[model samples]
Target: MKTGVMLSCLGIGVLGLTACGGAASSALDSYKPATVNTPEDAKRWAKNASAPNVYLSSTAVLGITGLNGQGQAEDTTCPKRNQDGNTLWLEGDCTDSEGRKWVGKARRESEAAGSDTGRFVYEGFGYEGTDTCGGKEIAGKWIFEGVVDVTGTEEEIHFDIDVRTDFTGPDEDADCAVSDESMAWDYTGTVVEDGSSKNTWSGSGRVGSSKIGVATVETKDEVIDMSVCDSEAISGTTTLTGGSDTVVITYDGATDCESSSTVQWSLNGEAKGELTGVSCASAGSAPAWALLAWPAVMLLWRRRSRDVRGGRGRRRI
Candidate 1:
């Protein structure tokens, strides 16, 4: 009888251990990390960074990405200037890192669609200090000021953006800012589906805010699927600020994630009005710890099960 009890106890212990292991695995799956759907979702970040609907941050990437203008994808860096109650003035030069560069100024209104509005301005520069086509000087700055409906969720964010661009210059000087160009967009985002700590974002928008007599404006919102979270550094993929009008830009500069913890940027999907990118990282260890506790619980359960089985077996024997 004693031998039978011992054997029963051993079997129960083995089963209990296995159960514990299973429990641990389950706990690990339930773990959740500190997540950010959009590292600096242009709208969300601007709201959080700006004041009470006065001036707001100038989204260089957002501005260019959502633009239905002509040219390849490139970076346009701007300098921070002064900010009045609801108006911000920024003056900077742009060097097309990967594409071409043009001089321009953009303004973002702090009000929603049906409320007050804002303005944006831009002036295209001559390539070699002179206009090429028809020897016509492309002068004057294109200006845009309008209202927008910006709405989105934690996992899925969307934007319905519309704006008007104009060009005006000396008609006799062969340079002018032409009005009648408009760009519109509809965007969507999905969180944490593409990678461990990343989200995929893409959207479509009209081109033109294009020139009337000039080339057609490519009205497509470029895909922006990028990992935009940075925990260790002050300046990385994501940046922080106090009010809406004050703008400070930074870079994530993380291309080779293996060498650096910083997340890199990439492009995905077709260019028919939208683009996408991915951001992923090593998951946190909290889940691993949670899973560790299950093994102990299962061991105890097995001991109890074995005791009950032994008692019944002995009584029958």
Candidate 2:
């Protein structure tokens, strides 16, 4: 499962650097994926990030650099709502049953509920970096944000999330094989109800790089449904197209409601053959990428919405 095609989206800027370290790093790598600077920082907090918020590819990647992914869980503070019940303020951390940890902070204006109808501005919600993790030299920042509509009824809801995430580095870990690289993605995405048993999701976005040297990604859209699943299980298919190439992942059995899913990865527009792990989990849990990645902001939307309906989205908030 060589699915590390993430470089195409964000970190491709570091591609040349990953190849010729010093020269490129001194020049292009000069841009160390900005941090929380000021209002001016808010102006460019998410600079160079784009995507439709649907696929598992890298938009801010520099190239394909596999590192020891997703780590242990930690406690977090996810907000329930602002003083006004309509405004769902996202500012916290959460560690799932799995050991994946996530921390996040919303921007000023765009950080809360967008409208009364239902809209959530996503922010970079990811893992807190460490100079060393499990004997690995892991240090980097992965953050994402965008607007999403999480308002819906009992069995159905509309999902339109514009996601932009920035992945900085594995910091050339000692224990884990990693490359010192970075990337970003800003794109659009949509999720619709197909029937009571299923839901359809799709999106399109662009990146400057790809593992296969391509630049576009199209999710002909994947279908997810738990019609036959239990409370702790989920099932679905992921149909994603990168540049001219496309791959699909089909969920045959039960998807652990707790974490990731190991599914069939195929390039023939059908999920078959090779086995791969994907990040498709329930709202409260973390996905594979997100397990260790930052900006678990989307969960903010899901959790907040649940809060609106008097559900558990705003647990511990």
Candidate 3:
């Protein structure tokens, strides 16, 4: 009887050890790194990393108020304006350079009328009518709010602006597909006169019918010269986090404006590998908001070199 009882205890101990080992193996597998072993993986990482910068520059190009004819939207007419004590309300309609109609309403402090610093809170801003893209009418909306501060002389004016934008649209992937796919983004950033920006953005909803899950982008002192047709970030590092993966991109700050960037990726804090010669230009090419919003908003505040002392049209550094 004694020998039988000892054998039974030994069997229970072995079963427990087997179950524990299996559980540990599964947990380690879950922490495996993302696929970053090829140049293609680097390209994909670069694209996602630079997306926040594109969004930042595009939003700056939209300006504080779309009423500025210098912006992408032109021929703005505000038919209604009401002043109630310290608050001012405005409603207007405008046509973008692409012929798409936009109707928006805003409220600002009445004191901002003649001030160089103020805030404009957009109550409603987006496409007013059928806006077609890729032979199909696309529906989307932009919720934007900004504060603008201008200082210095007109000859050498300086601008500092803070902006927040939220966008929701069909996740057609620029193909004009008919599906329930949709994507949404919430981003906020700041732009200064020197064309340097910092941005933090998060994505939700879906990307082409597949849930984007948890994704975010954070940029640090990113500088871009949009005047250049093939512009990419000239300097700075952008960190992009998606699910269990993290990608870090560092721009070479090449004076020639070449698309020289490096991408390093990791998963769950495990270092995977790194790649060079990654092109960040693709960031502007196909962002989440690329289809209906970003293309029209493609512009940036021209950066002026501090050493160059001349008129507005002079050479930039």
Which candidate wins on TM-score? 3
TM-scores of the candidates in the order shown: 0.25, 0.43, 0.46
Q: Rate the local accuracy (lDDT) of all candidates.
A: 0.22, 0.31, 0.34
Local accuracy of candidate 1 as per-residue lDDT tens digits, 151-171: 333343233333222333222
Give the root-mean-square deviation of each candidate in angstroms: 30.2, 14.2, 19.7
Which runs in model 3 stand beyond 4 Å of their true positions?
1-72, 78-104, 108-116, 131-175, 178-211, 224-230, 259-317
Superior candidate under lDDT, 1 versus 3 = 3
Model 3, 1-317: lDDT tens digits are 00000000000000001122222123222332334333454344345334333333323323323322223333234324577765666665655443434556665553334443233345444343233435555554444344333234312222233333334432223354332211222333332333233222221111110222223455565554454423455566656555555656555444545544444444445655655454333222221111122222211111111111000111111
Candidate 2 residue-wise lDDT, 211-287, digit = tens: 11123334443455555442211344434443344454454445344233334456544434534223333223211
Best by lDDT: 3
Cα deviation of 235, candidate 1, in Å: 32
